[model samples]
Target: MSFMIPSAIKISSQFDAGNIEVLDLTNPQDIQLSIRKDNQSDFFQWFHFRVQGAANQPLTLRVLNAGQAAYVDGWPDYRAVASYDRETWFRVDTAYEADTGELVIQHTPAQNSIYFAYFAPYTWEQHLDLIAQAQQSALCEVHDIGTTLDGYDLNLLKISKPTESEAPAKKQIWVTARQHPGETMAEWCAEGFIARLLDEDDALAQSILEQAEFYVVPNMNPDGSIRGHLRTNACGANLNREWETPTAERSPEVLAVRSLMQQTGVDLFLDLHGDEALPCNFIAGQEGAPHLPDTILAQEDRFKQDLAQINPDFQLERGYPPGKFGPETFTIAAFWVGREFNCPSMTLEMPFKDYDNRPDADFGWSPERSIKLGESMLYPIHQWLQADL
Candidate 1:
């Protein structure tokens, strides 16, 4: 009788935004793993980890608990992303076994050490780098609003052009993203928006700046982001749900941003996000809010139309049904902002799966496309301002 020996391939996930629990590493071909749940919450879907000593070797990794995740529908068409340098992430062959409830990732590593993630992670270091770079521009000012539950800085950027004769106060345009930490594409999009807003040579950006001031919070739940939680902060509180009545201990992140919005008064609001099940880019408007004005509805329609025309990657055909939030609508950021400010508030959702309208087999809905979408937002805002409503 002959017996096979288990190889010495190693796996780990102890770094930033890393979440994985190893089950069996006895065989590289059948390595077993499970995603760790968010702190104090049952939500678990995001996963990031590194594999070592498996270069040029075919391997199969299985997530045993994939069926029980918060969004099981996200698994059907999703492809896992991998990177050797952690800077350039590309999709690999991945499939979900409905019968076994396993998410299987198969790949042959070109390097001894390679990283994999649910999506391309936007790290805290990258966030810091983006803030530092943006602050160097004269049109931008960085502010440290408060500390998170984990003692991380909650940074906000205020961008506007200085003027001596202000005919009327520039409209206060508020943009926030990444309330769900796993939706890193939101921050990537925000970074692109900031970059173009500060660019001195971009005429569209300059025109928008002349009529509106931007208040942006790139990362809303830093604790959840750093802890690798999919939809909550340090205390397992979904920041979006706390907008109705945010507290200091449970959801200070929302309290701080909401308080600031109260002080500045929101004329227009946008909250960026990523939908796991959806396969296209779309906007969820605040039409469900009680007593929503027709003027605000008109503004929302025009903005969506402009965006669709600006980027074909964005479409208006498919999205959440109207009144999807139901009674819980006010708990969401967009609805709350719209109700409180009587302004045009929208939730812009990118996708974890490929954009079905303009699918890219190589890199489905990527950071590059998200950034371009962000840059394209200036046009609609300009159009809204030109309407002078």
Candidate 2:
């Protein structure tokens, strides 16, 4: 009698920004898996995991609960990202079956281990590294504004070039990203923006720093990010929706940042994000807010036009239609800030999938592109400030 022994294959998701639930791993060709929901919430979609002991072997990963996720439309045209060195992420073969409600990923690992995610993940450790890097520049100041429910620090970066003479007050520019923890592209964009702002040789950056001060929150929901939640913090509160009336227990992140904004007084505000369904980059304004002035509305239009001209990746044609928020307008961060400060407050949304007009087959809507878009934003900002003068 002869007996066949099963091969050893292991899967894990215990690291930072990792979320998955394994069902069956007996057969690498038919591995069964499911995405874990955010803590204390029903929303599930973000997934990151690792496969070990499977070098040069064909494998298939199936998420059985993909259809029940927060955004079903995000699956149809989506391709999952994979990495070997964790530094370079590339797109792999992915398909969605509507009937079975399954998301399938097929790949043959060239090495012994591989990591996969909904998109290229920006880890919590990476966030700390970014903060530390920014603080090394004499132009940047780091502040521990508050703490999350999970006992993590909430950090804010203030960047400006000091002048010896008593010049007129500079414009206060506020930029924040990653209010929804799953949208990792937002933080990536923030990284690029911060890097260019701190560049000593860049003429555009130096010119902007001479006239304006920057207040940036690179990762707004660290607890949710580390916990692998899609849209909420430790206690299941969406920070964006809590801007109108934030509390200490439910959303201390928003409470701390919003209080600081009130104290500092914003001249221009931007909240960065990633849209699950949109395939192109665009901006969504606060047109739904009550009592919006003509001047503020015109300023928003001019800023959009300037950005569209500066960055080819950004467009003006497609986005959330006007009045998309309806009665809940004030609850949103952009809308609340626009109404409160009467400035050009906007949400810059990147796509999870490839940009439809100019898609890259190997790497779709990647971190490099996000970072370039962030660097490109300085041009429009400089133009806006120059026009005012």
| Top candidate, metric lDDT | 2
Error of 1 at 97 (Å): 0.9
Model 1: residue 149 alpha-carbon error in angstroms: 0.5
Per-residue accuracy of model 1 over 1-389 as CA lDDT, tens digit each: 99985557889988889999999998889999999999999998999999998999999999999999999999998999999999888999999999999999999999999999998999999999998999999999999999999999999999999866946789999999999999999999998899999999999999888889999999998998989889999999989888999999999889999999999999999999999999999999986567888999999999999999988988999888878988789989999999999899999999998888788888888999999999998888899999984
Put down candidate 2 lDDT per residue, 61-131, tens digits, no spaces. Answer: 99999999999999988999999998888999999999999999999999988999998999999999999
Worst-scoring 10-residue span by lDDT in model 1: 161-170
Residue 179 displacement (Å), model 2: 0.5
RMSD of 2: 2.7
Predictions in order: lDDT = 0.93, 0.93
> For residue 64, what is the lDDT in candidate 1?
99
